[model samples]
Target: MDSQKKFWRSLWQLRVPNKIKHFMWKACNDALPTKENLHRRHVMDSTTCDLCREHLEDTIHALWLCKDISCVWSSLEWFHQAILVQPANFRELLARFRPCQDEYKVEIFVIAAWCVWNRRNALHFNRVVSLVTSICREAVFRASNVAGVGVIFRDNRGDPIGAMSMPVPFGQSMVEMEALACQRAVQFALEIGLTRVVVIEAFLNGSGQLASFENILGDIRFQAACFQHVEFNYISCACNSVADALAKKASSALVLQEWLEDLPDDIAPLVFREVH
Candidate 1:
């Protein structure tokens, strides 16, 4: 166990992107982007994509531009107009998005993309494929309605802590995304001076799971160890609605995060309305 810890410690010592390195300035919050999660709960398609045998079956091709995937891309008539790219790869595809000046549209893209992928994974595993257009449509709408804030603190655990709400891309780079998350987490950690805390999400684009915090980039290493002792966990969207609602309204309010043990009474209606 000690050796394993050393291995990750070595990675932190190694070189990482400069943009990510700057993330250390953050107070050590724990807001990680969804990590890669192509593995399955239970699907029967060959490990290789049925349509694109060149690569393993995964979300990238299914959502990007496989022949089967092309239909989905072609159908995003409205979104396509927002940015322009004939992506030969994922980098180009994401690059096409310019963080809308207001930052709200970027949130829509991130959250909706997560939902779209969720629906696709469901189809692949449960044989519940629905029209691609419908998925995109719901995603677009939910982008506007879906709400949740990731919470990062410096201590609640016996030691240290950090946490934050996930940020929307504002014509920003992936490195920028990591920095934004790290900044928020660090800010929270600095606020309380504990060793560890929780970073919960109301959304995921398959970046990182709730409890799995590793290699999350930035030269500083993990946020949980910011001071002494920190940890993380996940909550379902239904459970997260509380934070989501608070975050959306709370964002403009002069503070970065607001914590609650459960959904607030007044906001509960907004979540029900959004879902309905």
Candidate 2:
């Protein structure tokens, strides 16, 4: 009981976003909407995981043990230590990190778990599975501030055709930065003489009621009309590593960067991973 209390205390003290803390709380309490919980409530007919279909979908299995989600954890350097001890539940899995001195690793674990849950939901609903590298990149993105924008243009074969990265002014919200990125991507597409374009965004959920977000999205829509055919698809950050990497690169770059068919050394690996 004291350990449980200690867990709660440490959880609230962590520096992660409140939404992540709330998610951790739900996970610890088994209050998450996992298929097992949904089955108990008659909300879902099967407790089997939709992603793996090999085991019952509980908080632990969904977040940690699922084969599909396990790669996200395995790809992390610190996760090797955490994975040594088999956790019986989500709370136990988190508890392993609680005593660790490095708070950043704790934050990564929490955020990655949350992202895995999100990916599970996305796959369940949309049938889109994000790559392991994208999930890892997203964990880093959430922990940092928005400093720039990145855009990558890919062919229907998922080969890179062009890319751009640019530093932007700080102090704007993430949604605003995402909006700016979308605008820049549209402009990039137009400048390259691409008529039919597809914009895959990791943000820009279109649910933001903020006036600034609405205005920027409106501008993007207006600019998109310039294309003969354009489609905007929303995927979670778990599928946007190449652009995320470029944005991270642009955050430190002094000037706008662009590329033709050849991608930079750093981004080429990401695109290759996505293509294969």
**Which residue pairs collide in model 2, if any?**
none
* Residue-level lDDT tens digits of model 1 in 55-109: 6544445445456545444555645664354555433444345334353344344
lDDT of 2 by residue, 1-276 (tens): 997777799999887889999999999999999989999999989899888889999999988988877778887667877888788998888888887755366877888888888878877788666565557645645544336688999999999989999977654455667778888999999999899998998665745535856777788888898999998899765588899879878865647999998999989999999889
Best by lDDT: 2
Q: What's model 1's overall lDDT?
A: 0.42
Evaluate residue 275 in candidate 2 and report its C-alpha lDDT on the 0 to 100 scale.
Answer: 87
Candidate 2: regions farther than 4 A off: 101-103, 127-132, 146-276
Cα RMSD of all models vs. native, in order, equals: 17.7, 7.4
lDDT of each: 0.42, 0.82
Question: How many backbone clashes does every candidate have?
Answer: 37, 0
> Which candidate number maximizes TM-score?
2
Deviating ranges (above 4 Å) for candidate 1: 1-167, 170-183, 201-216, 219-222, 250-276
